[model samples]
Target: MRVVIAKCSVDYAGRLNAHLPLATRLLMLKGDGSVLIHSDGGSYKPLNWMSPPCSVSDVEVEQDQADAGITEIWKVVHHKTADMLVINIHEIFSDASHELGVDPGLIKDGVEAHLQKLLAEHIETLGEGYQLVRREYFTAIGPVDILARDENGGHVAVELKRRGDIDGVEQLTRYLELMNRDPLLAPVQGVFAAQEIKPQARTLAEDRGIRCVVLDYDALRGMADHNALF
Candidate 1:
């Protein structure tokens, strides 16, 4: 089995559904951390059908069969071989940051630094030796923003959104659901960090025992800067 990773501009699930043939099986890993697998009936044609099928002028029936076989094989190979695969929007671009007119590496660096600072500050508040789990991939869900172990022996999952959009809460709820199912993550508390949160959403989170923190750009920047100085 061979694994191939392709960069796709569209959503991974949509791309796979369009490209994968009916006979091939497909497994989709979503950015919001959802997993789905599809199985198609096996093909009727055999391999090595590339030769001319009898008296055809400029058209080979064998070639058509071979093409179909190859296409199905490619899909099967891609699905079976990959243990875990991510199809993030960021991976679509050759120079993603540059495509967005920003330095990709710098942006990543800044985000990592900011995350580290946020983790440190919050861990201290929770008490000592809290470690940050970076790029932790969850089953069904791809990667969460941050996963941390609190000093008091609790798990913490944080999601960061730039805007104060209520729609974003749906994704966080999915993450929380996954965490609740995992034995290792059951002790986890979910936190939503965004610039602003809708009043209804805040109320909903509070009712559900989730923590929502709203921080403006300047406030977040100040926290990062403060963490750096200390």
Candidate 2:
């Protein structure tokens, strides 16, 4: 992993286009070749990032650029989508690299966790014959939100998000990728479930042969409570 704090600007072109004016920010090149441009604020989220399955190449610094304090230019291209993230470094404050091993991934919190529990109890919300196998199904990479069995006896791996975007779909895809590797879970299907799923996310999910589920918190809870009364 490499970290560089530099005064830089960014431009991203692909599914969407974004630009960040020149500013001092932290640029992270993760072990998986993902690039993240971060500001001091914004919690853990980066100001801009390029997801993995990418290749990053550096451009030689010309003498004129060096005189202007522009020391580096990085061009990142996505392998599958051909999206690009361009980062131009004007001034470097710090630069270092670390050898960080495997990652355990995130634990859902706040509304996301609550949503997971709700869906687990009411796995039927997923489909008529779906039965909850477990919640927080742990794996080497991370815990799947919910694991279940569909009517046909196939496994289903669900990912819950408050607002499902392209990131959420990508996340679930990761989980499915790992989970399906095991012979026991070889046929696992993915469900991108969230209260609201963005159109782009839905399209991505469908393209990957994954199902998209729009969760209704109020109705889900009310149905669970009503079922309890019976």
Candidate 3:
């Protein structure tokens, strides 16, 4: 990763138009060829970013640009989408690079953990004859949200998310890949369950032969009979 602190202005155009006026900002150039421009604040989100699968090239600045205090230009172009991002740089302050290595991964936040427990208690909500093998089943990569067996006795690996996004599906896919390697859990299936799932996520899950289940937190509780929650 390379980090550069410089006086720069950014312009992005594609789905929308955005501009960042001349200011000192932190620019990040990732090993994957992606670039991000960040301000001093705003948590972890950058002011502007070009995601991976893009190319970044240093374009020569015109004489007029140099006269206007612009010394360099960086142009980033997306491969598949053809999106573009241009940064006009005036002066450099600091530049450095470091190898951070692979991340350990993220953890569940908010009420997501509690929701997983509730789902385990009401495993039947998944479907008739669905039995919970265990919750937080251990795996080499990490814990699988819940491991179970469907009515047909096939191994079912489930991943629960508060808001199911593409990342949830990706996580489940990785788990399924690892579990299917075990002879005992061969032919494992995946199910993505969440309170709310994005349409794009559902489509991606379907494309990968994974099933999606939209969950109901309120339905986890019952009045007369506990099984009625299913």
> Model 1: runs farther than 4 Å from truth?
1-131, 135-137, 226-230
Provide the lowest-lDDT 10-residue window in model 1: 47-56
- Candidate 3 — which residues are off by over 4 angstroms? 108-230
TM-score of 3: 0.53
Q: For residue 150, what is the lDDT in candidate 3?
A: 94
Model 2 C-alpha lDDT per residue in residues 81-166, reported as the tens digit of each score: 68799888888999999999986667667778878888888898889999999988875445788999999999999988999999
Model 3: ten consecutive residues of lowest lDDT: 221-230
In Å, residue 214's CA in model 3 sits off its true spot by 12
Candidate 2 residues lying further than 4 Å off, grouped into runs, are: 1-107, 228-230
Give the per-residue lDDT digits (tens) of candidate 1, residues 111-160: 54565356545544333676676534443433467777766668878767
lDDT of 3 by residue, 1-230 (tens): 99999999999986667999999999999876668888998654578777656788999989999999999999999776677999999999999999989766556775788788788888888999999999888764568999999999998999999899998888888778656645568789999999999999999999999999998876674421465666
**Each candidate's TM vs. the true structure?**
0.45, 0.55, 0.53
Residue 51 Cα positional deviation in candidate 3, in Å, after optimal superposition = 1.0
